[model samples]
Target: MTPPNTGRRSEASRRAVLTAALDLLQEVEYAKISIEGLASRAGVGKQTIYRWWPSKGAVIFDAFLMLSEGAEGGPVQLPDTGDLAADLTEVLRATVTELNEPRYEQPMRALATEIAHDPELAAIYAERLDGPLREAKRQRLRRAQRAGQLAEDLDLDVAVDLIWGPLFQRWLHRSGPLTTEYADRLVATALDGLRPRR
Candidate 1:
């Protein structure tokens, strides 16, 4: 029960809608982004957006997902270099780049601001953003622990937070420059403290 071109059209529409939603997020605040605006800018009907996504937050979250997953590669994943420090550094370095991208900055800020004000919106963002990102990090850390790259007694949850918390603070707070060097230093410091002594 599908036309030959239906899938193509749907794919195109999804891209268009995501594009328009992000564009509008930059133009307006997160609270202002609406399905109606996305539909208009995407050149699709409101029903089209509704058919694909249950809510506007879901649509914007999808856009964020697309950006994080990236276009060149299928999706971003934690690195595995057998050196846990190196892997974490590379992943964090890439995250710094993603955070600094001009296209992502405005929209992410809008989302953060919106989430700060709306608990429901915050839940949606948590599910869409943290759900994937945190879980991936947790898995990687567990693997590193099993490989003897980390302390056997270390709490994985605490380890994940220790790795991500500072960078996220710097990002959300605009504390200072987010550079590869900074990420590397963080990884080194954490590794020195976390890796079990021989």
Candidate 2:
């Protein structure tokens, strides 16, 4: 049985490990990060890292979670100004900007690469990272539903996916630049289909 103080120290060490992982990911590609290197950068023993995480991918997952602060793009709450188009436009535009930020880009790429290779990590990433953002968007859609701004038959879950899909695709594939104008167009297209006609 570990002492109560042991839990605190463990949490602190975990935080340090995550911080170091993020730093390393920024400095070097994901393929090069190692548990031993993470331990050194975190100022923790290698044994400590092994005691918690099984692989560097797991460390990257935790690091992404920490960097996202349990939410995507900053705050978790979606704006509900009663104007669904405007609110979604603002949110997606901000997401575009956040995805492009240098500090966030590396971890985002690392997480994506990790998920591609590891199914378990993919699940964890969805639970910790994608789920919260999806839920927030769902809640906002529900608000629009309540306001009768959106069609009663509008599938909230799919709608959320639809709104986010293009943004994620662009960011993940680097197919094109994400911009406020792109977000605005996406909002217009999505809302035109979902919103109640005048």
Report the Cα RMSD per candidate: 3.7, 3.1
Clash counts per candidate, in order, are: 0, 0
- Top model number, TM-score: 2
Candidate 2's displacement at residue 191, Å, is: 1.6
> What would the per-residue lDDT of candidate 1 be over residues 87-179, giving only the tens digit for each residue?
888888988998898898976776666677768878877776676778788888989889887789999889888888999889989999999
90-148 in candidate 2: lDDT tens per residue?
Answer: 88888899999999999988888889899998888788777887888899899889889
The superposed Cα distance between candidate 2 and the true structure at residue 197, in angstroms, equals 9.0
User: Model 1, which residues run further than 4 Å from truth?
Assistant: 5-7, 69-77, 110-129, 194-198
Q: Give the CA lDDT, 0 to 100, for residue 188 in model 1.
A: 88
lDDT per model vs. reference:
0.82, 0.86
